[model samples]
Target: MNLDDDIALAHALADAAGAVIRPYFRARFVQEAKADASPVTQADREAEEAIRALIEEHRAGDGIIGEEYGAARADAERVWVLDPIDGTRAFIGGRPIFGTLIALMIEGHPVLGVIDQPISSERWIGAAGRPTRFNGKPAGTRACPELSRALFATTAPWFCGGFEALRSAAGDTLLGGDCYNYALLASGHGDLVVEEGLKLHDWAALLPVVEGAGGRMTDWHGQSLHKGSDGRVVAVGDPALLPQVLELLER
Candidate 1:
C-alpha cells in the first residue's frame, strides 16, 4: 500500500472520529463498563463505527483493532488501530486533554499515525520516513540533557506502581493529559511521559509521533515497542534523556 495515501486516510479517519466525539464531549452520553471495567460510551462506539466505515470504504481488506470493538480480520497484512478517545476519563470529566488516536499498522508496526483533538482543532500526524507535523506545520521537540531539568507528565500517577520514583527522578511530575501529554512532548511542551497498562491502540499512534518529532518511546525495558508489548511506556522528547529516564523508571 502507498503510505502517503494511507496517511491521508488516517487523517480522514481521525476527522471522522472527531465528528462523532465532539457532540458527546461533556454531554450526557450513556457510559458503560467493559469486562475490563474501563469506560465505554456511545461516543466511543459511534466514533469507532465511523472510522470503520471509512476504512471499509477505502481499504476493505485491512484489519482493525479498536478499544470499543475488538480485533477484526486478525490475519490481514495491514491493520488500522483506533482509540476513539485515548483519555476517556478526561473526556467524561469535561477536560479537553483527550484525543482520538488513529494508526495504520503494517505487519504489526505503525507506519502512520494521527492524534486529533476536535475541541482544540489541533491535529498531529506522524508517518514513518516523513517529518512529523502539528496542524500541517513541522513540529519538533526541545532537548533537555538531564532528568532533573526535564518537565515530565503522565496520564496519572496511580496508574503506574513506580510513579513516586518517576516523579522523584524528574523533579516534578504533572498528572492528567493522556494523549495530550504525548502531544505536549512532541510539541516540546513537556519533556517526558510515562504510563503503564497501555494497550496497542493506546500507544501505537503516539510512538511514531514522538519519534518523528526528534523524540523516542519504548516499553520500560528500553526495547522497541511492538504489537505484543506489555504496555509499560516511557516517552522522551529528547532522545538523549531516554537511557537515564528509563534507568530511573525501571529502578
Candidate 2:
C-alpha cells in the first residue's frame, strides 16, 4: 500500500470534519445522550457524515467504523476509524481542546492516525515508519528524566484504576483533555496518559501518534494495542518510564 496516499486522504478527512465542526463550536445546537449516556451533538453527527462522505469518494473500498455512525464493510483489510468530536463535553462547554480523531487501521492495527483540534487549528499526524508532525513541523517528545518528575495527565481518574498512586508519584497532574491529551503527549507537552473504558473509536487513532512521536502506547500490561485490547491504556512519551509506571499501575 502507498502510505503517502492514505496519509493525504486522512488529512482531507480531518479537513472535512473541521469544516463541519467549526461553526458549531459554541453555538446552540441539539445535544443528546447516547445509550452510554455520553453526549452527542449535531456537530458530532454532521462531522462524521462529512468525513465518511470524503472516505467514500476517495477510498470506497476501505471499511469504516465511526462513533456516530455504525460500522460498514468492517471486514475489509483496511478500515478507517473516526470519532468526529471526541470530547463533546469540552466542546459543549466552549473548550477548544476537543478534537476530531481519525485513524487508518490495516488488518485491525492502526498504521496512521490524526488528531485535529479545529478550534485551535492544531493537527498532529503520525504513520507507521514515519516521525510525527504537528502543524507540518516535525514533532518529538521531550525526554522524561524520571517518572517522579513526569507531567502526568488523564481525562478522568474514574476512567481507570491506580490514579491515586500515579498522581502522587508524578510531579504534577492535569485532567480532562480526552483524545487531546494524547496529542499533547505526542507534541511533548505531557509525559503520560492513562485511561480506561475507551472504545475502538476512542483510542485507535492514538497509537500511531504517540508511538511515532518517540513514545509508547499500550494496554496497562505493556502489550501493543489492537482491536481486541482491554480498555485500559498507558502512553509514556519517554519509553523507559513505562516499566516503572506499569509497576505502580499493577500495585
Candidate 3:
C-alpha cells in the first residue's frame, strides 16, 4: 500500500474523531468509570465508532484495535490502532491536553501516526520516511544531558504499574500529558517521558512520532517497542542520553 495514502487516511481518521469528541469536551459530557476505573464517556464511544466506520468504509480488510472497542479482524496485513481520548481523565475534567491517537501499522510496525489535540487545533504527523511535523512545520525533540536538567513527564507514577524504580529515578517528574507528553517530546518542549501500564493502542502511535523527530523510544530494557510489548516505555530526546536514563531506571 502507498504510505502517503495511508498517512492521509490517518489524519482523516483523527479529524473524524475530533468531530465527535470536540462537542463533548468542556460541555459537561457525563462520564462513566470503566472496569479498570478509568473514565469513559459517550464521546469516547461515539468517536471510536465514527473512526471505525470511516476505516471500514475505506479500508475494509484492515484490522482495528481500539481502547473502547475490542479487536476486529485480528489477522490482517494492515491494522489501525485507535485511542479516541488518550487522557479521558483530563478530558472529563475539561483539560485540552487530551488527544486522539491514530496509527497505521503494516505487517506489525507503525508506518504512519498522528497525535491530534482538538481544542488547541494542533496536530503532529509522523510516517516511516517523513519528517515529524507539528501543524505542518518540521519539529524535533530538544536536548537535555542530565536527569536533573531534563524536563521529565509521566501520566502518573501509579500508571506505571510497578515500575517504581523507573519513576523514582526520573528525578522530579511532571504530572500528566497522556499522549500530549509524546507530542511535547516530539516538538522539543520536553526532554523525557517514562510510563507503563500501556497497551498497543496507547504506545503504537508514539513510537513513530518520537523516533521520527530524531528521538529514541524503547521498552524499559532498551528494546524496540512493538504490537505485543509489555508497555514499560522510556522516550528520550537525545539518543546519547538513553543509556544513562536506562541505567538510572535499572536501579
Model 3 RMSD, rounded to 1 decimal: 1.7
For 148-224, candidate 2 gives per-residue lDDT tens digits of: 98999998889868999999999899999999999999999999899999999999999999999999999999999
Stretches of candidate 2 off by over 4 Å are none
Most lDDT-accurate candidate: 2
Q: lDDT of each structure?
A: 0.88, 0.94, 0.86
RMSD of 1: 1.1
Once model 3 is optimally superposed onto the true structure by TM-score, how far is the C-alpha of residue 53 displaced, in angstroms? 0.6
Q: Write the per-residue lDDT of candidate 3 for residues 1-251, one digit (tens) a residue.
A: 78878878888898999999988888967678889887899999999999999999999999999999989986798999999999998998889999999998888888888999999999999988788999989989887776667777888878664345545555556888899999999999888888877998998898889999999999989998887788889889888778877887676
Give me candidate 1's TM-score against the actual structure: 0.97
Clashing pairs in 3: none
What does candidate 1's lDDT look like per residue over 154-202, in tens digits? Answer: 8777766578777787857788888999998899899989889888999
The backbone clash count of each candidate, in order, is: 0, 0, 0
Write the candidate numbers in order of decreasing TM-score: 2, 1, 3
| lDDT (Cα, 0-100) at 207 in candidate 1 | 87
Which pairs clash inside model 2? none
Candidate 2 is scored at a TM of 0.99
